[model samples]
Target: MPSSDAPSIRPRRLRSTPAMRRLVAETRLHPAELVLPLFVREGIDAPRELQAMPGVRQHTVDSLRRISAEAAAAGLGGVMLFGVPAVRDARGSGIDDPDGILNVATRAVQQEVGDALVVQTDLCLDEFTDHGHCGVLAGDGSVDNDATLERYRSAAVAQADAGAAMLGLSGMMDGQVAAVRDALDAAGHADTAILAYAAKYASAFYGPFREAVDSQLTGDRRSYQQDPANRREGLREAELDLAEGADVLMVKPAMSYLDVLADVAATSPVPVWAYQVSGEAAMIEAASANGWIDREAAIHESLISIRRAGADAILSYFALEVAERLR
Candidate 1:
C-alpha cells in the first residue's frame, strides 16, 4: 500500500512474536555458562540465612554438600566456595590448614560432584583474618604484598591438595597469579587451574558481601582493590594476569563493570567470567519483594546483559535457580 518513497525495510517483523524474537536472539543463556557462589560457615548446626541477601545462606558443611550436589544436578558450570571459620587469627592460619572449613568443604563438594562440575575455592585471607584484610599486615598495619604472596603460595598448595579444580586468586595483590602458578606447579599441582579476579573494583556494591561472609573489616580496601573510576586499569590487570598464567580472568560486580569485562573478553585467550556481586543481587531481590519488578524476568535480563557484554561465564547467586529453569 506504500508508495515508492515510503520505507519498506521492517526490523519489527523479527520482534513481532516471542518465538520470532527468540529465534533471532543474539545472546542465549545456557546452564553451562553459569557458576554459583556459595558460603559455608564452620561450626554451624544449620544454614544461617543472610539478612541482606534474601534467599542466600551461610550454609553448614552438610548443607553445602547437598546444595553442591543440587548445583551439579542442575548442570551448572561450577560452584565457588567461601568458608567462614569460627576462629580468626591475624595471620589467617586457617586458610591453608587441611582441617580448615574451606579445605574440608572443598574436599566434600569435589567428592560429591566428581567431575560433574568444577569446584573452585576462594584463595584469599579476608574470610579467615580477624582484621578482615585480604593479606597479612605489616608492623605499620599496611598490607605486606610480598609477605601475602608467601601466604598465597601456601594456600594455593593447600587448596590444590584439597581437590579444588580451580583457585580463584581474588586478593588483587601484585604478582599473585604468577606466584600462585609457580607454587601450584612446584607443589605438583600443575593441572590445577587459576581463575584470577583481574578487575575487582572497590565498589559500594560489596556492602552486602561483607555481611554474607561476616567480614571484620574496619577500613576500606582501596589500597589493594582497583579504584572504580579507572577503566583502563581493568584491562591492564587482565593482561598482567593472563601473562602470569591465568586460565580464567574475572571482572567482579558484573553488571557495573561490563565495559571492563567486554574489554578483557575481546583479547584474552582464556575464559572470561564475571561476578554478579551481593549488592547487585540484593537490589533485584528487594525490588522483586516490593513488587516493583518481575523477579524472574529481571534476573534473566541481568544475566543476559552480562553475557552479552562478553562474559563467557557468570558467577551469580542466581546460578542454581537459573540453571534449573534453563533445563
Candidate 2:
C-alpha cells in the first residue's frame, strides 16, 4: 500500500495499447447484435428522406429490398419495418390487409434476404389510424384498450402471413401480447415470435419517429405508454408481458431508461431488448453535424454504453451505419 514508486502500480498500463484496451474492454459490440428500424411508405416510388431525422428515409418496396439485402450482408440481426400508409382510418384496415404496404414490404424483404436476416414489423396502429392513436378511439376520443387488442390480433396474423419473423407489439394496449400470441398460434404461425414493448415510456423521444412515419398524432401516448417517472411500474409491465408469453421484452429510448433495461434484464426469462428511438438518434446526428462531436466515435460509445447496461440486442436508426463500421 505504501509503494508510491512501484512501476506496476500504474493504472494507465492497461490503457497503453490498443490490444490491451481490447483485452480489458468490458463490452463488445457486434453487427449481429444490432437491429435496424426502417420505414416503408405506401404509394411512394422513391425513397424520401425524413427531414427531422437526417440520413433516415421512408423507403419504397424496391428500396426496402435493397436495404434488407445490405443488412443481411452486414450481418445485422434484423430489420424492424414501420409502414406509412397513404390512408388512415378509425379501424386501421391497412394494418390487417394482406396487400398492405407493410405486409408487402415484409414479404419482399423476406424474399430478398431469404432467411438471412430476421424480418420484423411494428404491429401498432398509430401509423394507420386517422386519429394517430395506437388503438381505436372511443366516443370520448380516448384509446380503447380492449378494442385495440382485437385489432392487434388481426395485425399479428397479417404480419405473420406476410413472412415477418417477429411481430413487434409497441402499442402498449392491455393484453396485447397474449392476444397477438394466441392469434399467431391459432393461425398456425407458431414460428412467429412477439417482441413486446413492455416498458415503453411516454417520453418526448418519439418526436422524430412520428416524423419518420408521417404520423399525425393529435395527442400524446401518456394514457398507455409507461410514465417516465415510474421505475417499479416498468418491472410490473415486464412481468405482465412475460406472463402473457412475450418472446422478447423491450425498453424504448434505451439511453434514458437504462435503469429499466437493467431491471428487465435481471429477471427476464427471455431476451431483453432496447430501442434507441428516433429522437435519441436525431440528437446525436444534429450535434455531430454541428461539429460538436465525432459522429462515429460518439455513436459507438453510445451503443457500447447501452450494451454495457444490459440490452441483449438494440433496435436503432444507426444500425446500418454501426454495422458497416463494425464490419
Judging by TM-score against the true structure, name the best candidate.
Answer: 1
- C-alpha lDDT of all candidate models, in order: 0.96, 0.92
Candidate 2, residues 1-327, lDDT tens digits: the string is 767676767789889999999999989999999999999999977999889999999999999999889999999999999999999899899999998999999989989995798999999999999889999989998999998899999999999998999999999998999999999999999999999999999999889888888887887889999899999999999999999999999998799999999999999989999999889889999999999999989889899988998999999989998899877
In model 2, which regions exceed 4 Å deviation? 1-9
C-alpha RMSD of candidate 2: 1.6
lDDT of 1 at 31: 94
Q: TM-scores of all models? A: 0.99, 0.97
Question: Which regions of candidate 1 fall more than 4 Å away from where they truly are?
Answer: none
Provide C-alpha RMSD values for all models, in order.
0.8, 1.6
lDDT of 1 by residue, 27-114 (tens): 9999989999999999989999999999899998899999999999999999999999999999999999999999999999999995
